[model samples]
Target: MLKIRNLSASIDGKMILKGINLDVNAGEVHAIMGPNGSGKSTLAAVLTGRNLYEITEGQVTYLGKDLLTMAPEDRARAGIFLGFQYPIEIPGVSMANFMRTAVNEIRKFKGQQPMNASDFMKLIREKIALVEIDTKLINRSVNEGFSGGEKKKNEIFQMAMLEPMLSILDETDSGLDIDALKIVANGVNMLKRPDNASIVITHYQRLLDYIVPDFVHILYDGRIVKSAGKELAVELEAKGYDWIKNHDGDE
Candidate 1:
């Protein structure tokens, strides 16, 4: 569903992603494991066209369309959803209103009429149930005063509402207890389909245990140095990143 070829990016004239080549097929989950400052987040920002990063070289194709050329909203409208590590708070915007706007906007982009209030509400109710999110939270301002776990659940709620073709989860496992992590992972798993995919960027293999990846990639120093299967993640957890660093001749 997505193809990235020799992608390199920089921010404020400082290089971050050196060269990244990844292909994600529909229905597959790809985990990117890396140490801090290894550019995992930079890859997400570049894919979403977040504006801070400049693509120094290479191309990204999404469903045969030029993904890098599209604006952030366009990317979202085109079935790309990003679950941020730290979800932003919109103090005055109710979650319901925010999500309604997003859903209707994507619908309009697809040349469909905006859903009636009744239909929209029904749709949201179903999605909220799917994510096991509290309906009361939807009536409150987006992410406002939410606990860390609540914020992460809110992100998954948005994902369930949008039903994106490819979801980029940037450290979705960060700052959560085991139970909260399970809830979030279950929400993601429930959303998976044969035509949908996920790119899970995380630092630890603990999250991988809950959301087993089809492919596990080790990203180091702005590039992906090794690609393996689920067992690789367990090995990494046991051996730590130094093994990969040394294997890649970085130490």
Candidate 2:
């Protein structure tokens, strides 16, 4: 559903992503593993058009559309969901209100009528259950005073509500306890469909245990240097990133 070729990006006049090439088809899960500063998150930011990173070269096509030309909100409406590595708190905005507005906006973009209050409430309740989020939290401000796990789960909850065609989950496993990790992974697994895909970016292999990937890609120095199966995650864990670093040679 998404194709990228020789994609490079930079921020503050300094280059980050040198050349990234990836193609994600429906019903597939791709895991990107790498050490710190390897541009995993940078790739996500570039795809989502975060406004800081400037695309210096290459192209990204999503569902046959020029994804780079669209605004970030338009991209979200086009079914691109980005689960942030560090979800920021938006105080004074109730989760219900925040999500209701977002959903309605997306609906408008699709030329559909806005969901009624009653229907939106029902939908939110059902989706919150899918992520095992507490209803009490919904009434509170978005990510306000929430723990790390709660923020990550909230991101998944938003993902469930939006039902994106391609989900970019960047370090969704970070700062999460085992229980929280399992809950997040289970939600992602349940949301998987034949017409959607996911790109999971993580440092540790533990997350892969719960959400098995069809392809495991080792992203180093802003480029995907190695691509393998799920077994690659296990090897990375046992051998560490240095093993790949020493052998692969720097760009």
Candidate 3:
């Protein structure tokens, strides 16, 4: 569903993501692992059209369309979702109101009419159950005063509502306790289907225990040096990233 070729991106004048080539077909989960500043987040930013990183080379094709040409909003409406590492707080805006506006706007993009309040509330209730979000949480301001786990769960709740075909979760496991981790992972797994794919960007191997990616990639310095099955995550957990750096070859 997504294909990238020799992708290179940079911010300001500094280069990051030297040359990344990856392909994700429908019904597959891909995990990207690397140390700090290895361009894991940068890849997500570039893919989502964050506007800071400029693509100097290569191209991305999403669902047979030129993904780089689409605006960020267009990408989202086109079934692209990026779950942020640090979910920002939107004070004074209740999640219900915020999501209602967002849902209507996306519907507008899709040439659909806005949903009535009755329908909107019913849909919200159903999605809230999908993520096991509390009634009080959705009525509060978006992520405002939420704990780390609450914020993360809210992100997945948004993902469930958006129903994106390609979900790029950048370090979704960060700061999550075991219970929160399981909840978020279960939400993600529930959203997975034969027609959708996910890119999980993470550091440690623990997250993989729940998500269980079909392919694991070692991204170093900017390029993906190796790609392997799920066992690669276990090996990395045992031997550390230095082992992959020393044996940088396709596995």
Candidate 4:
């Protein structure tokens, strides 16, 4: 569903990603693991077209079209969902109204009629249940005064509502307790289909236990240094990222 080749990006004239290459096919989950400052989040930002990072080289094709050329909103409308590492708080807007507007906008982009109030309410209820999110929180402003776990679950809730084809979850497991982590992973697993894919970027291997990936890639120093199967995550857990740095002769 997504193809990236020799993709490099920079921000404020300092290059961050230096030649990233990967392929995410339908029905697959790819995990990106690395230490801090390794360009894991940079890859996600580049793919989602965050505007700050300029693509220095290479190409990214999503579903056979030039993904890097599309606007951020266009990417979202084209079924690209990015779960932020730090979800921002919108203090004045209710979650219901915010999501309703977003859903309708995507539908309009797809040339479909807007969902009616009754159907929208039903959909909202279903998604809230799917992610095990608190109903009371939905009536409040987006991420306003939410606990860390609550904010991450809210991100998954939005993901469920949008049903993006390529979901790029950047550190979705951050700050989540075991129970909250399980709930978030369950929601992501349940949302998986034969025609969609996920790129999970995380630092710890514990997240991989909950959301087992088809491929585990070690991203180091703005490039993917090693790619392996699910067992690679287990290896990384046992050996730690220092092993990766040493193996790559960084010292």
Candidate 5:
């Protein structure tokens, strides 16, 4: 569904990603495990057209379209969803209003008429049930005064509503108890389908236990140094990153 070739990015002229090449087919989950500042978040930023990062080189193709050339809104409309590491708080804007706007925007982009109040409400109700979010919270401001877990759940709630084909989860496991983690993971798993894919960027392997990936990639020094199956994640957890660094040096 997505192909990234020789993808390099920089911020303020300092290069961060060095020739990243990755491909995600439909119905697959790819996990990117790396230490802090290994360009994991940068990759997400570049893919989502965050505007802060400059694409020094490379091409990103999504669903046969030039992804990097598309605007942020276009990317979202094209079924690219980034579950942010730090969800922002939007005060004075009810979650229902915010989500309805997003849904309508995508619909407009696809040349469809805006959904009526009744139909939109029905869709929101079904999605809220999928994410197990309270209907009352949807009536409140987006992410305003929400607990950390609640904010993360709200992100998934939006994802469920959007039904993106390619979901890039950047540190979705950060700052959550086991119960919250399970809830979030269950939501992600339930949404997976044969025509969709996910890219999970995380620092720990614990999250992988719930959402097992088809491929595990280890990134270091702004590049992917090793790629393996799920067992590699357990090994990294056992031996730590230094082991991989030393092995890479020997190679």
Candidate 6:
């Protein structure tokens, strides 16, 4: 569904991603793991069309179109969803109002009529149950006064509702207890379909225990240094990132 070729990006004239290449197909879950400042989030930011980063060299093709040229809003409407690592608060905007607008906009992009109030509310209820979110939470302002776990669950809830083709979750497990983590991961698993895919970016192996990616990649020094099966994550957990650092120098 997505292909990246020699993707190089920079911020403020300093390079972050150098000669990075990746391919994500439908029905696949790929995990990106590395130490801090290894350019995991930078790659996500570049793919999402953040203006701060400049594409120094390379091309990104999504659904066989020039992905890098599309605007951020266009990207979202085109079935690309980025679950932010740090979900910001939007005061006074209730979740129902926020999502209703977003869902309708997506329909408009697909040349469909707006969803009626009755069907929209029914869809909302179904998604609320899918993410195991409290009914009252949807009435509250967007991420306003929400606890850390609540915020993360809310993001997953939004993802379930949007049903994107490519879901890029940047550190969705940053801060959460074991129970909350399972709930969040369960929602991701239940939402998985043959026509969809996910890019799971995380630092720890614990999250992998639940999501169980089809492939695990070790990114170091702004490039993917190693790629392997699920067993790679267990090895990384046992050996720590020092294993990668020591091996990276050898190559």
Writing each residue's lDDT as its tens digit, candidate 2 over 14-68 gives 8888888889999999999999999999999989989989899999999999999
Single out the weakest 10-residue window by summed lDDT for candidate 4: 242-251
lDDT agreement of model 2 with the native: 0.94
Model 6, CA-based lDDT: 0.93
The sequence of per-residue lDDT tens digits that candidate 3 reaches over residues 4-108 is 999999999788999899999999999999988999999999999999988999999999999998999889989899999999998999999999988888899
Instruction: Give TM-scores for every candidate, taking all chains together and pairing residue i with residue i.
Output: 0.97, 0.97, 0.97, 0.98, 0.96, 0.97
lDDT of each: 0.93, 0.94, 0.92, 0.94, 0.92, 0.93
The sequence of per-residue lDDT tens digits that candidate 4 reaches over residues 140-222 is: 99999999999999999999999999999999999999999999999999999999999999999999988999999999999
2 or 6, which is superior by lDDT? 2
In candidate 1, where is summed lDDT lowest over 10 consecutive residues?
Answer: 242-251
Candidate 6 wrong stretches, greater than 4 Å:
249-251
Error of 6 at 88 (Å): 1.1
TM-score of candidate 3 relative to the true fold: 0.97
Instruction: Provide C-alpha RMSD values for all models, in order.
Output: 1.5, 1.2, 1.3, 1.6, 1.4, 1.2
lDDT of 6 by residue, 29-73 (tens): 999999999999999999899899999999999999899999998
lDDT of each residue in 42-122, candidate 1, tens digit only: 999899889999899999999999999999999999999999999999999999999999999999999999989999899
